[model samples]
Target: MGTYFIVREIQKDQETGEVRDGEIHFTDSNPYAIAYAEESIANRVIDLLREGTSLNNIREMLQNRHIR
Candidate 1:
């Protein structure tokens, strides 16, 4: 098996139809922060994962910083 990292959530871009990653936390660098990636986008990202789409492919389709 390959090594993997767990995150807060998986998101997707509506404009470019690409998968994105997100993390939710209130850290020293971002205290009082509360940003959640769109649930709709998460659904889309999950759909792609279920379909066996690679994240590398999704990253290639991104226009926003969302994928990074």
Candidate 2:
């Protein structure tokens, strides 16, 4: 079995009432357990958000790296 990572974020702009959705997935047959992969991916996503990167950009980057 392979490990999977699902990263999703939803945000709304209060002023413009705009909604933003971001999602990414990474799967690997690595030895690490699924829980570990999930934690790592979650942390990386949070870091990207803290750096002020847009959700769309983050999803793009992740997709470029590895999707599903």
Q: List, in order, the clash count of every candidate structure.
A: 0, 0
lDDT of 1: 0.45
Can you give the lDDT of residue 52 in candidate 2?
A: 74
Clashes by residue pair, model 2 = none
- The positional error of residue 53 in candidate 2, measured at the CA in angstroms, is 0.4
lDDT of 2 by residue, 1-68 (tens): 43355344567889999999654434443332222245566567656766777868767776786422
**Top candidate, metric TM-score:** 2
- TM-score of predicted structure 1: 0.36
| Model 2 spans > 4 angstroms off | 1-37, 66-68
Model 1 residue 61 CA deviation (Å) reads 2.8
Error of 1 at 49 (Å): 0.6
Alpha-carbon lDDT, every model: 0.45, 0.55
Could you tell me how far off, in angstroms, the CA of residue 4 lies in candidate 2 after the best superposition?
10
